[model samples]
Target: MSVQRGGLGRVTHIIGEGLEGRIANRHLALFGLGFVGLFFVLPILLLIPESLNLGSTTPFESYRRVANGIYVDAFVRSFLYGFVTTVVTLALAYMLSYFLAFSTERVRTAMILIIVPLWIAYIVRYFGILLFLSPAGPLADLTGFETDLLFTTPAVIIGLANVYLPFAVLPIYNSLNAIDEELVNASRVLGAGKWRTITKVIFPLSLPGLVAAGLIVFILAAGSFLGPAVLGGPNQTMIANVIAQAFLDNFNIQFASALAIVYTVLLVGLLLVFNTLFDLQEVLGNI
Candidate 1:
């Protein structure tokens, strides 16, 4: 009888401990959610009222402006730039990641030489392109080319690529590092060439990083204002640029808030698609 009572007590203690653990975990989760709600979610929610208020004087007119064609144009342009930038950045980062992962020590040294530009300040690096492509800058002086690249579509892309390349690179590099070497060796032993081995065995395994880097670059490029503002002219304006102009130039906080809300929705939708495709946590494992 005593033994049975002791067994029952042990079971009861285990159950109580589990219950306590669950309660503690739930409390921690709620606290974390509250923090996020206060900091991140609240500010976004606030945007809705500000965006919808129209104005102090003209309440009905604000909604009309937000639905105008200009915002739609900016949205489309922003998405286009983001897409192109994401593709180029992904390709370059993938190549660099592959080289860094599999190259011999001497090759790695050469690869590092290529990657060193990523350490430079973004504005400085972008403006350097201006200098290179400007008619009075080095390229015109040396090569005798008269065309200027400033304020062009390519300039915006280059600026965005320079700024966000590192974001793509690190994730891909970490994924490459996590690859099993034996698989590559086995592919080679089975009469696979270097290209074949990489395509067949390496790239398929790096899908997680590919998805991660692409999504990250997409998000950063999509939301970026500085690069477009500095490097682009009227034709290259983006959603972020319009939003900034709304706030700073026009003082249309409500319309800017609306644009911002739309931007947030776009990013959220993209992020959801990405999270569904690949686990960002798994992709960014070591980075």
Candidate 2:
């Protein structure tokens, strides 16, 4: 009888403890939600009112002006630059990642070399590209063949690709590394050549990582300021530059806020399309 009572008491104690743990977790979740609401959500909500110029008769005037003006060209240029950067970055990163994952014995050393550039300040890195591509820079001096590249669209694309290459490499390397050696062996045993095995098996499996890396690179390139600012001419200026001009140079807060709102909505819509096209949850899980 005493043993039974003791067992019952212990079970009750465990149940109480579990209840307390759940309550604590609930409180922690609520606290985190509250913090996000206060910081992120509240600021975005305020931006809406500011963009609308609320309590005045002329609401949405800023949005109409932005939609009809040269800002549309800025949006197109930004998307073009972003697409070019993503393609270039993905190509280089995939090659490097494949070598590191499958071909290299000195993976750690190579990875360190790849990651070292990230430690440098972004402005410094962009400036370095500026100098490197200059008419009098090493590339020009080495080849003795220099046309104008400084402050150009190609320069911006190259700079963005170089800056975001590391981001693409890491995800791709992780995905490639996660691939089973047994699968490669099986493909070989099944009379598949190395290239065939890679194309049929390895590449397919690595799609998730590729998607994740591509999306990340595209978004970063689209929104980047430093790349265009340091390496691009007036024609290369992106939507971010326009937003900065509206806010800082023109001091048109309503116009800037409207641009920001539109940009955010477009980004969100793009993300939704990506999620629908590719299972972003699965892609991120692979990463």
Q: Each model's TM-score, in the order given? A: 0.78, 0.88
Lowest lDDT sum, 10 consecutive residues, model 2, at 1-10
Model 2, span 1-287: residue lDDT tens = 35555788889988988887467667878989999999999998888888986777878799888886589988888888888999999999999999999998999999999899999999999999998999999889999989698998889998999999999999999899999999999999999999999999999999988998999999999999889999999889899999999999999999999988998898889889989988888777766
State the lDDT of candidate 1 residue by residue for 1-287, as single tens digits.
34555788889988988887467666878998999999999998999888876446766456567678978888888989999999999998888888787775665665566578777877787788777778798888998887757899998998898788878887787788789999988999999999898899899888778887888899889878888887889988999889999999999898888889888887788777766766777765634
Q: What C-alpha lDDT values do all the predictions have?
A: 0.83, 0.91
The model with the greatest lDDT is: 2
| Candidate 2, superposed: residue stretches over 4 Å from native | 1-35
Q: Candidate 2, residue 158: CA error in Å? A: 0.5
After superposition, candidate 1 runs with Cα above 4 Å error: 1-37, 54-63, 106-121, 274-287
Q: List the residue pairs that clash in candidate 1.
A: none
Lowest lDDT sum, 10 consecutive residues, model 1, at 54-63
